[model samples]
Structures are given as C-alpha cells and as structure tokens.
Target: MKQFTYVITDEAGIHARPAGLLVKEAAKFASSTTIAKGAKKGDLKRIFGVMALGVKKGEEITVTCEGADEDAAAAALEAFFKANL
Candidate 1:
C-alpha cells in the first residue's frame, strides 16, 4: 500500500464536481483507493463515499492505494491532486 496526505487548497473543497472527477480518476487504476479525514474513511472509487466525508478547505486527507498497481496509482493520483484538488 502507498499513501500520502494532501491539504485541500480549493475554497470549495471536494464538492460534487471534483468528487465525481476524483471517482473517475481513481477508477482508472487497478489498485484499490481510499481517502481518509481524521476518523472518517471513504472509498475513492465511490462518489457518495467521498462526498460523505465532508472534507473542507485546508483539511488534510490521506489517499491510499493498495494492489498490483499501487505505485503507478499513487504517482498518478499525486499529479491529479496537484492538478485538480
């Protein structure tokens, strides 16, 4: 498994559009993906799970990848966060 934390820079945080986009990006990977904020954790591939986390601006979230393609998934997602989050 590979994981890293990101502090949301978007004023709107992970709202609907971004959440949907995130789900799509995560789905492109073979690795299982998950995101966590404090005690709350959600599957990154599931839109509702991501939205339900209630992540806010400047909040730290840990994105985790596990499975065969975890390394590539982690690298791609890191870039995704830089570009989108």
Candidate 2:
C-alpha cells in the first residue's frame, strides 16, 4: 500500500466537478483507492462516498492505494489533488 496526505488548496474544496473527476481518476487504476479525513474514510472511486466526506478547503486528506498498481495510483492521485483539489 502507498499513501500520501494533502491539504486541499481549492477554495471550493472537493466539490461536485472535482469529486467526479477524482472518482474517474481512481477508477482508472487497478489498485484500490481510499480517501480519509480523520477517522472517516471513503472509496475514491465512488462519487457519493467522496462527496460525503465534506472536505473543506485547508482540511487534510489522506489517500491510500493498495494492490498491484498502488505506486502509480498514489502518484496519480497526489498529482490530481494538487492540480484540482
């Protein structure tokens, strides 16, 4: 498993459009991806699960990827968050 923590930089946080894009990005990986805020964790490939977290700007999120493509998945997700969230 690979993991990275990031603080949301976007003023809108992980809103609808970015959340949707995030889910799509997670789905592209063979590894399983999960996003966690404090004790709450959600499937990164599920839009509803992601949105349910209510991630506000400046809040910290930990993304974890586990499986065959964990490294790539983690890298991609980190890049996505930096670019869009």
Candidate 3:
C-alpha cells in the first residue's frame, strides 16, 4: 500500500467537475484507491462516495492506494491533487 496526504487548494473544494475527474483518474489504476477526510473515507473510483465526504479547500485528506499498481497510483494521485484538486 502507498499513501499520501494533501491539503485541498481549490476554492470550490471537491465539487462536481474535479470530483468527476478524480473518480476517472482513480479508475485508471489497478489498485484500490480510497480518500479519507478524518475518519470518513470514500472509494476514489466512486463519484458519489467521494462527494459524500464533502472535502473543502484547505482541508487535509489522505489518499491510499493498495494493490499491484499502488506505487504509480499514489504518485499519480498526488500529482492529480496538486494539479487539479
């Protein structure tokens, strides 16, 4: 398993557009990806699950990827958060 923590910088938070993109990105990997805000976690591949967390700007979240492509998935997710979230 691989994990990274990130603070959201987008003013809109994990709203529809970016959340949709995030789900799509997570689906690209073979690993199981999860995003957690405090004790609440959601599958990164599921749009509704992610949105349910209500992640907001400046809030910290941890992303975990486990499985065959964990390394790459973690790196990509980190970059994705930096670039888009």
Itemize residue pairs with steric clashes in candidate 2: none
Per-residue lDDT tens digits of candidate 2, residues 1-60? 999999999998889999999999999999989999999999999999999999999999
Evaluated at residue 22, the lDDT of candidate 3 is 96
TM-score (all chains, Cα) for each model: 0.97, 0.98, 0.98
Residue 2 local lDDT, model 3: 93
User: What total of clashing residue pairs does each candidate reach?
Assistant: 0, 0, 0
| CA lDDT, every model vs. true structure | 0.94, 0.95, 0.96
The candidate scoring highest on lDDT is: 3
Return the number of clashes found in candidate 2. Answer: 0
lDDT of 1 by residue, 38-58 (tens): 999999999999999999899
Q: How close is candidate 3 to the true structure, as a TM-score?
A: 0.98
lDDT (C-alpha) at residue 2 in model 2: 99
| Candidate 1 positional error at 6, Å | 0.3
In candidate 3, where is summed lDDT lowest over 10 consecutive residues? 76-85
lDDT of 1: 0.94
